[model samples]
Target: MSKRLKQLTKNADKNFNQMIIGVLIVAIGIFLWADKNYFFWPPQLRLLMNSEWSDIVFICLGICLLFTALTGNRSRKFQSILLILASAAVAMLLAEQVWHVLGAHKVEMIMAVILDAGLLTLLIRCAYKN
Candidate 1:
């Protein structure tokens, strides 16, 4: 096999491993949040409208933005992550403040799920692509 192909193969493996580590770190952090509160710290489906969730969502959005800015080759991955973060921020804001079965909160919730799923898919793709 060509040297370039071998180098690429090795690099791809390293990227795959990094992605696995990233997934595990995120999963563990989320699990820790759940353990602490019996749910995510931000508390989805807020009926009382806690401002704390908004803060957490904002932080997540910021992190997504930072990742997108830092990783140019992983634009696809971070683009989806950014969408998810945006949806999360909107959903948390609406769910906590709006509080209705068929209100803005519902749309936020739907967008959150769609974007999150897309983000996961992008991450998976990026993991394999190197």
Candidate 2:
């Protein structure tokens, strides 16, 4: 690729990463605000809040995996796969809590599962591309 094209692609990727980080920060902020303002939490979230050692360890592991996936000097395919798995784990954990809070019905559960599977497949395919 030409130098100018390469530079543009790099800048685009950097901007996209920044956007992802910004969105994640905003989502966390909203979650914290809601937690503080709301009187009740779902049992699952309450359990997490109660700070069981296992839950804390699991959360730390997930965060570490995410950090490594983002910042490690690994092959693109490897990093992409790691990123996808880490993201899915985190997303599912949060989604489960939300589902509990919402008292999710069967249809909702099925939809979520289908969506997650489809997303996973797409990410895997993208990661494998040259």
Q: Candidate 1 regions off by >4 Å?
A: 1-48, 51-54, 70-73, 100-130
Candidate 2's displacement at residue 8, Å, is: 10
* TM-score of every model versus the real structure: 0.31, 0.37
**Quality of model 1 by C-alpha lDDT:** 0.45
Q: What's the lDDT for residue 8 in model 1?
A: 58
Compose the digit string of candidate 1's lDDT tens values, residues 1-130.
6976776565445454333434433443344344433222234633224334444555555454444433432656655655555544444433432333244444444554554455446545543553
Cα lDDT of model 2 by residue, 1-130, tens digit: 6976776555446434423432443343344444442223454566455344434434443443344434432466655555565455545545654564466343434554555455445444534541
- Range of the 10 consecutive residues with the lowest summed lDDT in candidate 2: 17-26
| Candidate 2 lDDT score relative to the true structure | 0.46
Quote the lDDT for 127 in model 1: 39
User: How many residue pairs of model 2 clash at the backbone?
Assistant: 0
